[model samples]
Target: MKKLSVFFALLFLAFVSLPAHAGEIPIGIYGTLTGTDTDVNGMSYGPKDYLTYVNERAGGVMGHKYVPILLDGKNSIPEEVKVFKRLVEVEKVVLVNGWSTGGTKALRDQINTLIKIPFQAQSLSSDVLDPQKYPFIFLLGPTYEDQVLIALNYAKQKGAKTFAFIHADIEYGRAPVRNALEQKIPEKLGLKVLADIEYAGGSPDLTPQLLRVKELNPDYVYIQDSAGNTVKILRDAAKVGVPAGKFFGNNYNFQHIIPGTLGKDAEGFKALQINADWGENIPMMKEIEEFGRKQKIEKKDAYYTKGWVQGKVIHELISRVLKKTGGKIPEIGQFRIMLKDEWVKLENFDTGGGTPALFYKDHQGHTQARIVEVKAGKFATISDWIKTR
Candidate 1:
């Protein structure tokens, strides 16, 4: 009897020590944690860290803990598809925050027909903006087309007529330029498209491309590539006498590393600014800073801010669902459908100055961005917030 009593006591202690939450809510976060585009890995780490903060600080959102599953897509489509299957089939995540324009485009059909979970993509591709067609997918900012138009409009305002495009030879780099041209946006902005050039990402030298750009002598050159490639483009532009001041970049290229890498060569480089930079005075940064004290912040830049904002959105939606369900998590299928319905209703959502107040009626939260130029080794806002709606 004494031995049995001791065994029962141990079992009771173990059971009582279990987490207070009824269950775990798995959320998938996948990005280029490795491979060529690792410069953007902050997009993946931001949400993971924020959700971790939520688990520790808030005790898992009304008795259900958030479990963020991180995966590396290696910036490859097949690899991303594999990661998607594992996140949906094996882990059974209710929501996903994904990365890369190419990967998002590849998974759109599957996300709509098979998985049916809410996907918050980092890609601002206009192709996925149609809520009627791609109801389950969402973006946090303006489309790539919008970014191009904003740059073109800025160029036109600066008294520039002809412009050229230099992009990486990838789906992400090619799509924005293609979309802009097909839509005739440059012509509408009173700007002519002179040359569209493609170069392999991380090329050793872009002197040839810059020479071609110089010969064309377009008043402005818009760059569509990652930060590393942007640095290369700037250095090679200087080498080939293509004035660096005449170049502009998309959001991905507006990175601190550019000026840090190229020094004076990166000065006067400009790109679209979507999320506020790290350490900016904002309400959200307080929470992130507090969390950082306890944990290491993997990426400390605008992309991380973008991810933190995404985490905020996820927390809001999940809280709403829990409230509606009376704190009881519905079955996975019902929970996913509820999430999708709740997302479209999100309006004027506060991001703590991460971006303009986000509205998800069109499945794209913020459609406004400002242009920032590299000055004295940092990106400084050069224009007021431009609305792309």
Candidate 2:
């Protein structure tokens, strides 16, 4: 009888000590954590590192600790849709973040049609801003069109009289390709676009295409490639002495290619990244660099940058959400609206400076990119601060 009584008391104590909301205040975060899939950018670490940043200081979102729900989209269109639906129906998480371009587009209609929960996407495509189309989706960066325009403007300043374009055949590559092919952008910028080319996935050698471009001698080359093949393309171009002096690419490659395998040949490569590598010579970089050192996150690894940016955005969103609804479980719809509405404060727009804004309504952030140059051996920044875009 005494033993039974003790067990009952222990059981009651356990019940009382349990967290009030063990399973509540659920927020879903999914990305390409581990897999052959690479198009998502370094988004694989964005949420995890951001959450680590949050938990390191403050307890959790709204004092209710969060449990990150990780899912591997496998960089597939259909698989992403399936996983997203499972995240909604099976898990019933309140909010979500981190779906790449293909995955984000896949969920566009389904999210609008059935699930009303607001989803935060790491991708910065223009398509997400259409409220009627993707009512529940919010993009994390500027539109693809704006990023391309920024690259275009840079090409003009570099005196690119004509352009040669190449891209890995994928939905992610389609935007920049179409933007280059369809638009009279070069004419407006007082330049000419000479050659536009497409190659099959995993083409192994871009030599034929690079050879053709060399023959054409376009002053600039515009390209987007799968993450795996980006290094090879740059290597091939360097060997052939392609006439692409001013090479421009969208965000897909900037975070993925540089500071690594692309090697010394990729030094002069210039890309318009939505986010700059505050990885060097910046206050945030300094702070995170110290933290990274402690965490053994190599400065060369782009995850540190992606994590830092994700932390910044998450910090802003949490602050805004708290101010609006302190302790209560916020209305999911209203919370989604707030998530989309809040913007992170950025130091310089783009790579260096002179741009005044960080974000605007048309699915774009004004952040400039570091004008990285390949000097001596590897990628070096000719101008740490590029003011144009």
Best by TM-score: 1
The TM-score obtained by model 2 is 0.78
| lDDT of every model, 2 decimals | 0.90, 0.60
Best by lDDT: 1
Q: What's the CA RMSD for each of the models?
A: 2.9, 5.2
Native-referenced Cα lDDT, model 2: 0.60
After superposition, the stretches of candidate 1 with alpha carbons farther than 4 Å from their true spots are 1-21
- The superposed Cα distance between candidate 1 and the true structure at residue 350, in angstroms, equals 0.7
Clashing pairs in 1: none
Deviation from native of the Cα of residue 51 in model 2, angstroms:
1.1
Candidate 1 per-residue lDDT over residues 1-389, each given as its tens digit: 99999999999998877644478899999999888988878888998888999999988888779999999999998999899989999999999999888899999998887879999998888877789999999999989889998999889999999999999888898998999999999988888899999998767888899999989999999998878888888998989887678999988887899999888888899999888888899999999999999999988988898899999999999999998988888899999999999999999999888889989999999889999998988888988999987
Instruction: Single out the weakest 10-residue window by summed lDDT for candidate 1.
Output: 14-23
